[model samples]
Target: MSIDSIADAIEADAGEPIPGLREGLEEMRAGRSGRRYTPEQLLVRSARSTLGLSQQAFADLIRTPVATLRDWEQGRFTPPGAALRLMEIAVRHPEVVRDAAA
Candidate 1:
């Protein structure tokens, strides 16, 4: 007859108990969490750090110039169209990058 009754009827038809609805509601509650960085960004950082390379050295590894790497890191310049795509690919496929380099 009412909304609550209608919900109960639907739950009954579905053969599901609604008693744990509170748990579902609690699960829906928002929680604090940090935002994640993009794969390309993380890869750039990791590649540089892992190789113990400066921006210039990292740039060389990625087949770009030092200034470009610096710009990418500092947000002063984007990696350029194709360059950005390459960075994304490298990020997603680190082993590929390494194998290619070797």
Candidate 2:
């Protein structure tokens, strides 16, 4: 489609507004971001990144099996419930986790 035609279509749709966006904004205005994430939503690599550790080092520090840690990082498998909980804890308190692991 031509640029002008696309612009016209977008302008027309703009009047309708996106559903729920206003409600979300109001929730945020009321101090609730409405953001929620389960531990399973966290990636293994991200947890390690927050701690500033390499894969092998992170696995060793956490005492997680290297292969299992790799599997999680590679998406070959998601961390199990217990592992996910640990990852959440690690992300939230990297120093404590690191010290305790040590």
Candidate 3:
């Protein structure tokens, strides 16, 4: 929906009870609400974290530029198929990536 339509809907429902709004708010207040990440972002981040490596280190391990890794993690660009597969391997077996890096 357009921003104008969304604003109009909000104005119309100003005093109306919004379904699940209260529950969602409560979840946030309880610190249970989590930020969402795209699959590419998650994959890159997960792989890095799984290996306990910093972004630069992870990028080096993968033979990718740090800037490109950052872009992938930030969802600015999707990683190539080979990179994705390598990251998948890293996530599943971080030791392999670490050993290879050594």
Candidate 4:
């Protein structure tokens, strides 16, 4: 849809507060969005995002269990040595260590 179409849909939201947001959202759905990040390098969330992978996919890629990946991401447990090293690689060179399909 064009920006004008998104604008027309905006008012159709029945007086919602963020009608102007529709255009940006449409752009995002078209793969034309930008993201800002906080530099929390040691966090598992950061590692997974660096590789542009979902949590489950990142776990599978790194040969770690999903539950363990969750624990590390949620800060419930420390990442083990192997997991830590893998995350380090993700942090340093995500495109290098990450697979194309992942």
RMSD of each: 11.6, 10.4, 10.6, 9.7
Candidate 3 lowest-lDDT run of ten: 2-11
Expressed as tens digits, the lDDT of each residue in 1-102 for candidate 2 is 554454456657797545565555567667886655444545576789999989899889878788988877766677877888888788888888878976
Worst 10 residues of 2 by lDDT: 34-43
lDDT of each: 0.65, 0.74, 0.83, 0.71
In model 2, the number of clashes is 0
Query: Model 1 over residues 10-80: C-alpha lDDT tens digits?
Result: 68888997785544444445453335455555656665665566787668787787877876665555556
Put down candidate 3 lDDT per residue, 8-101, tens digits, no spaces. Answer: 5765779664666655555766789667679878998999999988999888888889999999998889998899898899999988888888
Instruction: Please state the error at residue 46 of candidate 4 in Å.
Output: 1.0
Model 3 lDDT at residue 27: 73
Candidates arranged by lDDT, highest first: 3, 2, 4, 1
Best by TM-score: 3
Candidate 4 residue-wise lDDT at 68: 80
**What overall lDDT, based on C-alpha atoms, would model 3 receive against the true structure?**
0.83
- TM-score of candidate 4 on Cα atoms, chains taken together: 0.53
Q: lDDT for model 2, please.
A: 0.74
